[model samples]
Target: MRLDPQKTEFDLGYLGKQSQISVYWNLSSPQLIEQSIINKEANLSPTGALLVSTGEFTGRSPNDKYIVNYQEPSDQEIDWGKVNQPFLPEKFDQLLVKVLSHLESKNIYVQDVLVGSNPQHQRRVRLLTEYAWSALFARDLLIPGIDMYADGPDFTIIQAPTFCADPQIDGTLTKTFIVIDFVKRIVLIGNTQYAGEIKKAVFTIMNRLLPGENVLPMHCSANIGMQGDTALFFGLSGTGKTTLSSDPDRFLIGDDEHGWAQDGVFNFEGGCYAKTINLKKDLEPIIWDASQSFGSVLENVTFDEDTRLLDFTDSSVTENTRAAYALDNVARRVKSGMGGHPDHIFFLSADAFGVLPPIASLSPNQAAYYFLSGYTAKLAGTERGLGCEPQATFSACFGAPFMPLNPVKYANMLREKIFDHHSSVWLVNTGWTGGPYGIGSRIKLPYTRAIISAAIKGILEEAPSEYEPFFGLKIPGIIPGVPSKMLNPVKNWESPDKYAEMAEKLKAKFRKNIDQYKGEIDSELLTLL
Candidate 1:
């Protein structure tokens, strides 16, 4: 098979002989999009956005993920267990050979990119994909500032979505697998075309490598205000990290992964991968407009074939429908993809229990405690097996799937950063209020926005506050443009007794979940729980 005549100097010799594959290296977005259309891999929307549907599996397959338990560094460092499952090196090699063999007769697209926005910590990543659309996705989600001809990649990701592994032979749990061999600095992905896997695999690598360099890799969104005040929003999927940080009033640094270093926070990605399900133009005009722009990659989003228009409300494909576009697509964003140490840090939780106040001021210890707990409700379609109902869950650091180290590592880093920067941390509940998920209504977007705005503007610092004894959160008595009663969850509830019961239940869940990390975290932080 012939290699693309326009190939770069990046070598593929280490991946055994690749004589059977037609390798297309470093194709531009337009070229990749055109290839995708020619190969019948994706369709062009009316707005010129590339629309692709990830068949069968629409979300990440966490159960099938693994990390090679090869010697040294990774073996001793990675907190290997359920989250970071171990895969034998031999098995990885076998799977790699099989995957490469499968790709022999097919076209493979390669992209050379960087992972971090800051040059100091930037990681050269080379992505090899079976589909042209997947290569376009990698280009859209990753920092494309690297010169492929200059140096080889620090890490390589080979994704073959069409190559299904035999669970028995390949040592995979299923046909789908995402295995990371840190020692080899290579990642393997198969059977799943949910583009997010490609994005998050790089994040997982950063999470493992950054901590040692004194950089706290985070699963959060960040923005800067007019006065140059920067704010961070940390939360799990469907908790509004992307939505809240895409504020028109502020300049966005990045929408997903970031690294908080000694100087400031720098984004890990060059783009924003935003959830598009139930997306409203009125509420999230920035993301809405970006999703409708040309060169953006829309994954699993429903559209009218004749009109070529997207229906953001439709969830038949999957609620996890997403839009991937470059950071430039956003009008209000930091061109450098970096922000100063945050003045305010918000831990957003979609508390389906509805017992948490709409907004609560968090002490240092409280912030660390909540950060480690990473309490949030698992919304439907965010992952496989989650039904329509929201289920209360604790994902340490709000990104346990991507975090390879102990939760305490990130928690301690956050505590140190918060104390070092004198940043105010707030627990903002974007979840249901008044009652539980089904019984109570979700908090209004406008009201949540008002509370966040007030906090960022430092309007609620000296506001009259009352302590919530159950969680020990200080609830603000008043917020500009929001009803005072809405700030206090107990007051919004129909039955105070019911709210107390739900609060107690959630408190128990927190204590139980945090117990696993009891010995590692500070006893003082535990007391805040």
Candidate 2:
């Protein structure tokens, strides 16, 4: 591999010249695999994929993430609390020095990559990591470096996973820290070894910056039909966003992270980071095939010692087992990873509470209401602290931690876009039915897929519909392959009284969440509800 010395000349003014850095620039996937093995950082699976364990942290540490309070153009614009916590600029400088100091004599792998498939909004990103596998992970997930030295980077990330922080000195709650200074276009990551951090930090950056430009960034899966119609699936982890989007028939644009711009919907990532827990080849052929590929990275997944076969059922490490692979590996995927304006947008919810209908059509206001509510169960192992059991939660726009602006901003943008594009919105519950979580069996994947197919084919559009009183969602009375009774949650429940009780509890939760966004939300949405 040819080392581009020009790309190495990044302006690391915070890093001193005395630091002896071994820089590996733009290494090919095979070269990176060799380096990882040489450095004892990764083990190759029998399938030839790179397998590595993220020690201690199997998921994202949201509490430790913070953005520097630069008090500039973005200070007031940033929604500053909890998810978007503030870090003093002084503390950031101190920590930056500490991070650079630790990496002074270490071998650092650098990948100058690109984000955003749209040419107009493409962001060149420079990633520096202490681990070769982490660098490869970034390369697998982000757009590869090609003429990146000429393109230049919009943001520079310095990641030192082994470098620990002092809470008392750093003013951080924990030893791990993910500090971002948008003002300086720099990201500092320390202590945490989870690769998901790298993926999400960049997403947070985009979420913060894109709205001001009138771009609606979404944490969803998107695909285009053969006829050029595009569809988007929005949901939290384990809600089948990745699973449903990888349909054998549709052309996948991307599995996650997309932006709805004036021209169309463009992918923000070059790859798909898919949850592999209980993944069966027959169920998810696309992702399953990709996970077994040579360049893909498997995180916290178990494999047999002798056969070296993966055990998707194993959750000893974490249930949030994942596989990261480029989009090209999928059997059917868009070449450019960009799609025309989406004609159908489905809000996916793994309704563990089992009160939501299997599939329902939503009005514009209902779409905005549910979008802001972002109602879904928290999938275990997706975050730093979570279990396999479903936990009901509301994340604004389905990506609260990543959104920098207020929830209403994204909701408003989505409403405007839906109106302008004449998009049809549907609510899909990929969670449970019969009863909540343990009481009921999880919804079958085939059934969910059939329901989704009906929506995508526009069959549900002409179907007879009935109003789901609590949520005010228009439940279709019949779908081609779906059981007529399953279309409405109330009918599936053995006891109507219990169904009503559970539905009321969920409605209360929704009301409580929406109350926080009272003035910002349209009164029409409330009336529809």
Candidate 3:
């Protein structure tokens, strides 16, 4: 179905119904593509994808994101800190009035979508954006609204990219802000043109709201084998969640954002938003093909002046350059976007320190520990203002920015699910090896794929295993396709002494980061430190 401008309706409380605003409701993808070009908000790439530039901000402004501290009894459960920074409800109300006032007489695009794949625990979302391109991004990423005439949305997002916040008056850190009010079930975004802010605002909300219902929200990728064995790939940005899960032999459930229920895992998104910086056709053919499709949206990606051919290798625009396309754009995607309870889970990390093993199996206790630690390296250009040098990062559950509850809340859910489903968990390092970054080269993609293939084929289950004391991970002594030297990271290092030195340093850092959780979590699991 397509939008009917004549029949468009809205409430005056949030939006002035009598104003000269042109509200386009529920437009189809084709309509949005055509409108975006006509409005000159975006251009058409040579590959037929919609191309748009998110000026100034190409990545999320995490520090600017605030959660309104309404002091509701339920909000007392929220673990508030720098990541889940608090905002005054009075400030939020003032900002809402200003945002709604700014949109009074301007053209806006509205969309209704669903956030969760499982109908049993889905959220009805209503999105209102100032740009047609942003509306298309939301429509392509989230499930289309099922009941067009349904009642009020469970959550509403009002985004005005052009409206700048007054730091002095708004009590904000910058001219841009992303504020989420759980009590009001509303999110307000201003001054940032980044479309990811819209998608992630909802994700952060889900990460906060879902755990209370016993549904574990995750920042991971999932795929299923022909026999219905589901596997999850967990990692931070640049850790290869999108790259590894696009396996030709498997059916992809989703590339990011999923929920684990009592029955199984379900994707939260309807499409894949993949990083496209320095992308090579031979390296990641699945993502390359999807980026060239008709209905895709390319953000901050540049093309040749005459040929219009994308220069994926170029980082002049930003390394966070991205491509958004429907899940069906990929050849081997699961149609239902639902999978059996994950039988296997893989935690991926690009260990810049080069001390962790390339691949290691984990016991239930060890899995809980590492899962809570959620260790990885943040590559340069992955986020706004990040330098070229890789920096060590420890985000709980691999997604600290989105997690509002205590880390133990998520860790407990993962422990319960793994035991209930009898799932096997493994830690895979897709990062540098032999030595730290600059000294050692990154792990080859082919080798990483082979390791994952063996794990999925059950090759590692019965293989000879060796335990590493520092991280407490069980290393598989031998695998059919992988090199034996690569099995243990320390073996390939130039100096065994230096390797041991670095390993001990990382273990110390892990302890320091999780010390705050000691009183709240299982003390036995912390012994893995």
Q: Compare the candidates by TM-score and give the number of the best one.
A: 1
- What CA RMSD would you report for each candidate? 2.2, 2.2, 2.1
For model 1, the superposed segments whose C-alpha errors exceed 4 Å read 1-11, 17-20
Which of the two candidates, 1 or 3, achieves a greater TM-score against the reference? Answer: 1
TM-score, model 2 to reference? 0.96
lDDT of 2 by residue, 1-529 (tens): 7543322434445343344455777887888888898899888898789988999999899899999997886588889999999999899888887888787668788898889999888888989898989988998999997865654478888899999999999989999999999977889899988999999999998998888788999999999998999999999888888999999999999998999999999999999999999999999999999987989999989988777788889999998899999887887999898999999999998888899998888888889999999999998888877766768999999999888889899999999999999999999999899999988878889999999888889898798898978887789898887788888998999999999999999999988888887676677765545
Cα error, candidate 2, residue 429 (Å): 0.2
Clashing pairs in 2: none
Q: Which candidate is the best by lDDT?
A: 1
Which pairs of residues collide in candidate 1?
Answer: none
What C-alpha lDDT, on a 0 to 100 scale, does residue 114 get in candidate 1? 84
Query: What does candidate 3's lDDT look like per residue over 392-484, in tens digits?
Result: 999899988888888889999999999999999999999999899999889999899999999989998889988877776789999877789
lDDT, residue 433, candidate 1: 93
Q: What lDDT does each candidate get? A: 0.89, 0.88, 0.88
The per-residue C-alpha lDDT of model 2 at residue 359 equals 88
Candidate 3 C-alpha RMSD relative to the actual structure: 2.1
Judged by whole-model lDDT over C-alpha atoms, candidate 2 comes out at 0.88
